[model samples]
Target: MPAGPVRTRDEVVTALRDSAGVGMGYVPLGAAFGILLVTSGLEWWWAPIFSVVIYAGSMEFLAISLVTGGVGLAQVAATTFFVNFRHVFYGLSFPLLKVRSPIGRLYGVHALTDEAYALLATRPHAQLTGPQVLATQILCHLYWLTGSTLGALLGAGVGLDVEGLGFALTALFVVLTIDAYRSAPDVGTLVLALGCAALALAFVPGGMLVAALTAFLFVLLGRYTLRRRRVA
Candidate 1:
C-alpha cells in the first residue's frame, strides 16, 4: 500500500484548527497566567520565556510564587515532581507510540499539557500521521507562547475580563469530569473521589491538581484490590 501522503498544508491546517480548537480556552487561560506571572514578580518577558521553555502550565504558575518567595532549587524540584509526576502516567495512557519517530516522540512528550493530552488522545489514532501529531503539538505550543507574550506585553491594560478567561480551564475540566462520571459504572471510582477529596482538603498544598491525582490513585488502588479478589 502506498504510504499515506506526507502531511501537507491542508493536513497541517486541519491539525492547527483541531489543536487550536482545544486551545481556544487555553489562549485566554495562558494569557491570564501571563498576567499573574507579571503581577507576582516575574519580569514581563519571563512569561513568554517560561511558557515557551517549560511548556508546563501549572508549573509556571507555581514558579511565580516560588520565585517571589526565593524558593530554593531543591524545593522547586520537589514541587515540580509532586505536582507533575502525573505526566509519568501519560506514558502508560498514551495511544500514539506506534507511529512516531524519536524526534516526534520527544516533541509529543514535551507538549503533553492536560488539555492537549485529552484532545490528542481522544482523537482517532489512525487519523494522526506523524506530521499531523507534530502539527497539533506545535499549534498548541504556539498558542501558549503567543498568548503569554501578548499578555505580558500588554499587562498594564489587562482588566477583570481576564478572570473569566482563567475560568475556562476550570470549566473545561468540569465538563470532562462530568463526562467521566456520567459513563462510569465503577463504584470504586466514586468512592475514591470522595476519599481523595477529603484527604486533599486536609493535606495537599497545591490544591485541585493534587486532590485530583490523589483521587485517581485511590480509584486505581481500589480497582486493583477488586481485581485481585476476583482472581483469587
Candidate 2:
C-alpha cells in the first residue's frame, strides 16, 4: 500500500481535531467504568491504573468482578487472551508501517483499540501519516484517562448511585454490532453468528462467548478450505 505524504506537526493537529468528535464519546464511557470500579470496592486510584495499564475497555469492566471475586491469575490470563484475540487479526493489516520510528510503531500497536482502528480504517491509506494515527490514538487514550479519573473522583466524593453503569459496555457492543452489520450486510455471516450463539448457549452457557467464538472459527476455517479447494 502507498504511504501518505510526510506530514508536519500541523497535520497531526488537524487529524486530532477531526477525531475530537468521536473521541468525546470515550469520556463518558470511561467515566462509567471508573464509577463501576470504585463501587466494586476498589480505591479511586484504581481507575487510572486500569485505564493506563489494562486499557482493555470491556475487559476492564469484567476485571472489576474478577478481582472482587478473587479469580485466579490463570483464569484471568486465559479469559483476557480469548477476549482480546481479535486484535491479532487487526494487526495483520493495520498501518503500522506508516509509523516512521520504532517507538511510534510500538505505541501505535499498544494504542490500537477498536475505535482507533475503525477510524483509521475509514481513511484512505494514502491520506494517513504516522503522526496523525498516533495523535488519534493518543487523544482517545487521554479522553479515557481523563474521564475515568473524574468519575473516580466523583464516585469517591459523592457516592453516586451508579449501579446502571454496567450496562454501558453492553450498549457499546450493541452499537458496534449494528455498525458492523450495516457495513458488511452479509446474511450468511449473520446466520452463522446466530447459530454459534445458540449452540454456545445450549452446550456451554457458562463460557458462551468463548464457545461461540470457537465455533465461529471452525466455520470460518471450513469456508476457507472450501474456497481454496475451488480455486485450486
Candidate 2 C-alpha lDDT tens digits along 1-232: 2344444666678877866754566777888888878888999999999998888787888899999999999999998988787677567657778889999988888888877776676466787877888888888889888988888889888876666665655565566566656765879878998999999999999887778877887897898899999999
C-alpha lDDT of residue 191 in model 1:
78
Compared with the true structure, all predictions reach lDDT values of 0.73, 0.80
Off by over 4 Å in 1: 1-7, 156-164, 176-232
User: Residue pairs in steric clash, candidate 2?
Assistant: none
> What digit string (tens of lDDT, one per residue) describes model 1 on residues 31-82?
8888887777567889888987788877887888898999999999999987
RMSD (Å) per prediction: 4.0, 4.2
Over all chains combined, what TM-score does candidate 1 have? 0.74
Point out where model 2 deviates above 4 Å: 1-24, 65-72, 89-100, 117-129
- Residue pairs in clash, model 1: none
